[model samples]
Target: MFCYKFPCGEFQTLTKMTETGITFDPPVYEQRYCAAIQILEDSRWSNQIKKVVEFGCAEMRFFQLMRRIEKIENIVLVDIDEPLLRKNSTSVDPLVSDYIRRREGPLSVQILQGSVADSSEELRDTDAVIALELIEHVYDDVLSKIPSNIFGFMQPKLVVFSTPNSDYNVIFTRFNPLLPNGFRHDDHKFEWTREEFKSWCLGIVEKYPNYMFSLMGVGNPPKDLESVGHVSQIALFVRKDFLEMQLENPLVTTPNLDDESTPYKLIHSVDYPFYVDTRTEKEKLWTEVQIELQRFKKMANLSENELDSYQETYKVPIGLILDRLHHVGATKEALLELLQENNLKIDDECVIIEDCDEESEGSDLYELSERLSQDVILTDQEHEEECWDLNQES
Candidate 1:
């Protein structure tokens, strides 16, 4: 495994990997963020979500959970902590880089070092922006600029932010009598009450007519326990224009990244698994097609020259062929291309013998198919072979 070098000569590694990716923080703190991710994932406009920009993406634990949204292709992590961003970028240790390289699918993960409250060049293609458990950490001056920077300037379709509810800190005060200024973390400059948060959200939409707001809560206390509000209060701001545009036309899914310029610095970027496979797509599809053909040959007891015999050539329905291909994960679109390349017959439902020679007795469906295929076929039995204790093939 080769390691990527950084100018600082410091090594960074992504040692902690998990489905929920809760992070070093307490579960309740992380769970609030996780709930925000669930809300975005379950929202009606989720399928339209393609590119997302996450503000204050500390350690990128939340980004891992956000992958549940199937259509999300691009995730950009923006944080002012450049060293922390570099540490989580998998830019140093080979072991960590190998793990990141092995992550499956095509989601592009980018790390940027920049303050969220700046007049930075906007990533125009962003569908949604997430800023969970972030505002409380920002200084009051910087915090004031966020609504205008994110809602007015960046102008993504949706924005979801969560801040610790000061009202809910009574539950924490029971355990620790010295809960500092009713804030969950010492780093947090300030925490807000439910009403304060609601007022802030309303004021944002009033200033920027492009968006409308919704309020939700997460991490409710037990029913028997007294109500002190949720562990965190969430505000979801959706673009008013986006809702109006949907009424007149079908969703425009394709990204329009016309302004390629960006103020954010690229700290790291990684392409997940299957970006380049050892086998070409055609080769992989053809391998499955040949295996399915062999299975058909074996099951039917097809003779070498049986397809060339008299008026009726031995054959199976194209539908059945596709079904077998489906079992082995060959898509219909790929099958069409593979068949076209190999000169396979596709006449409605029937799959006829390819390059059939009427004069030659040796030309059968199995024989012709075997000759036509560019790959070697293994029996279905071999595919189902039990794994050995060691990695070596038996």
Candidate 2:
């Protein structure tokens, strides 16, 4: 009945329809955070986002996704709860901060003990501010201060806010009986319906005439159940004055922020693995290969143990490893060169240990993996720059 062209330049026709209808479970609350990241990534000013502030950073689980935005140089996390912030920021138990800090990039993270309702001189003029699942937990008096403190005073180029929708409480009650009277969390003072949420966002737009706003839902119900709206709602606001200023002067690359000020007490920080543009491209990549190859070596060792279920010939899949390396801007030639240098081999199906001996009963594979785990030495060690020139350690 319908024909469609596919990406491979092939056309397909749909001839029959299934009688069974599709079903959807209730929306997951994590969709709220995903919507925030998508909004930033797809924004018209994506290139303009060099700094972002995550106000009301609960447990900081969403911080991982924020690190992937290529342009973000600094991320500021603020939460009022001192005890909770200390635990999350500490490198000890429930290691949220430590986990997010494993990456290596030009990016740096700063954690502060502060309330969103209160304004500070250091927290002024950011590219974007994300307050997710935060406002509902504060009292009305504190909640009122957000608009003046955040939008009026700080005045970021973009702002995103999300909260639980009370209309979707019925769906939640089935899974969680102790929702504290249909609210998402026990600490929340109040959750708003879709109408109330939209009205509040509109109020911000009207109060601050220099900004524009849009509203959308996350976690829609099944096809015909349109009456039940999303379990969570998102309100995104953009600064109109700033964008107009940008249009008039396109070459102004600097954001309206105080990058040199140090009012915020620094907490956990990380540098993610990103390539640099330098003259020694090959040497730098070779050093990085020597560093990150340990991950695949351990993976191969673990695969040997599960060989009974997988193919005994060799267990690790090559495509998955390639895909991961591709993320760090590694080429296929780089991967092949690294593996060959480390005495590793791959056949048509799986990555094979060079000395994988059936007679040794997998002991050879384990030992080779252990040996490769040692520090990888670069071929051109005396070539002016040492291995540490990449500024990375295994």
Best by lDDT: 1
Give the poorly placed runs of model 2, Cα more than 4 Å off.
1-27, 90-105, 173-182, 241-276, 280-394
* Reference-based TM-score, model 2: 0.57
> lDDT per residue, candidate 1, 262-326, as tens digits?
36788988655434467976777777676566556555555456765443344657677788776
Error of 2 at 123 (Å): 1.1
Q: How accurate is candidate 2 locally (lDDT)?
A: 0.62
Candidate 2 lDDT by residue in tens digits, 159-247: 88888888876654555564645466878899898889978988887777767777776666544556767666778887775445332
Per-residue lDDT, model 2, residue 362, is 43
Kindly report the root-mean-square deviation of model 1 from the true structure over all alpha carbons. Answer: 13.0
- Measured with C-alpha atoms, the lDDT of residue 144 in candidate 1 is 86
Q: What TM-score would you give candidate 1 relative to the actual structure?
A: 0.59
